[model samples]
Target: MSQTTARSAPSKSDIAVVPPRRPSPWRDRLSRLDVKASPYLYIAPFFLVFGVVGLFPLLYTGYVSLFDWELGDDNPVFIGFDNYVELFGDDQFYKTLTNTVSIFLLSSGPQIVIAVLLAALLNARLRMPTAWRVGVLLPYAASLVAIGIIFANLFGPNYGLVNSVFELLGLDRVDWQANRFASHIAIAIMVNWRWTGYNALIILAAMKAIPREIYEAAWVDGASPMRRFFSITLPLLRPTLIFVVVTSTIGGLQIFTEPKLFDAMPGSNNGGSTNQFQTVTLYMYQTAFEGQHFGYASATAWVLFLVILVIASLNFLLTRRLVR
Candidate 1:
């Protein structure tokens, strides 16, 4: 009884156990950003260069389109809407516009189809798959200027290989540069020849990403190769196909190199002797540099730019819907 120790009274602090605090949402977000910092830094240079060179030029062009900007002159004459007005009244503008659209249709339609077919072939179990892949991209490595010149000779008015073949087959030698339809077709051939393999490679890459399991499953269901391509591959490849289409359209609109060189004399600046193969881009070039009407060319650029925007939007919308 005498040895009883004094005991401390029960205090809330002694009895209670404190729990650890959870991190704030802001801190968590900051940590996540820290983890992703490397990737963002890696891609920063591309965005920076693109913004500086690509975007800046595009924006500057828009601004210049609003004024009369003459080459070799620092003083930009502020003439609002005059250039646009003149472009509408110009007959050559309409002709080139129609020509551009026609060539785009002719080139892009067959290009996509042939690319898909080629991609399918490339995807097949064949010897030297790697070699075939490399070979397909060979045209891409060749000089576009050389391609244009060679094609020009092939479709020449007389003594060209194409005409010689036609003569052997009892057909008349079609003057490619002289007629509108023939000229467009010739340019389209050039376009297809140069770009089809590249497009095939693009679609092939997309096709490779598709799961073999899906294809095997389709095969197990007795689906033929063509059926599987149409049902499974095509559906999965829609997004990639859309990307290809949009990019092709953009490149198609800038169809200067092939058509410009398609002339009898390379670098004539005029599309052809009669301007039969003149595309919108060729017209823009002639107007800006040859005719020295920088302001009008800018206006033409803006018109085509708007048309591209509209067509791209429509393509995206239509593709999305069709895929669904």
Candidate 2:
């Protein structure tokens, strides 16, 4: 103890502390911008494109619907809601609207049912699955014009294959183009033929997305194939089913080409001799191009748009509920 020497205190040089770097204003600003604005920037292109192509046209059409904008008019007269008022009162408008709804019902109901059945078949283990899938899609890929022409001939009242078959079966020949209900049925068949397989493929894709474990577990629990499909598959497929139903509703309401080409008279814009099978779109085309009533046609188009919106919404809600 007496021989112990005093120890020197540690100096600052022996334990140096590095100072933290100062944050740059530019870097801070960049970080803030990324956090606040990057998500908006990423989605800006979609909004911009929609504004230009979709929103603009829709608004312009509404604007045009307010005016008396015929084809040859130098100045379109602004008639507020007159076109819509007239459209609501017009008998021809009502006729076409009826036809449109009838055709939509006839086509969409059977189309969905057939598509679901077809999807179920396609989902099963099969020989040459790829070939089967591709074959189903071929009709959708084929030219609409060619299909319309072929169907038109096939359903022709005289000497058509359908009529010939009916005669062979001792059934009276159907005037597909002349009779209103018959025309609707014929066009519905054409629509189903063209679109059922396409919808089936879409549903099949959704089926493939379902987890196999659930299916396997259900099978292990002694669930029949039908039970598994109804209990597990359909419940999970509600979203896809809603999508299919809504889209089919929209497309069915706006049907044009099939009805247009089904007309036997060449270059005729009238749906039939009495405009029996004239759909809303066909009527709009006739009013705009043939009758040159652009404003009226625009009104018709808007009405159709609203109708489709309402029906599609109903379909989505109903399908979701039913599936649940």
Among these predictions, the greatest TM-score belongs to 2
Q: Tens digits of per-residue lDDT for model 1 on 258-303?
A: 9888888756877887778899989999988988778889899989
Q: Flag regions of model 2 displaced more than 4 Å.
A: 1-23
Residues forming the 10-long window of minimal summed lDDT in candidate 1: 1-10
Report RMSD (Å) for each prediction in the order shown. 5.3, 5.7
What lDDT is obtained when candidate 2 is compared to the true structure?
A: 0.91
Model 2 residue 83 distance off true place after TM-score fit, in angstroms: 1.0
Total residue pair clashes for candidate 2: 0
Whole-model lDDT, candidate 1?
0.88
TM-scores for candidates 1 onward, in order: 0.86, 0.90
Q: Candidate 1: lDDT of 143?
A: 98
Q: Considering only N, C-alpha and C atoms within 3 Å, which residue pairs clash in candidate 2?
A: none
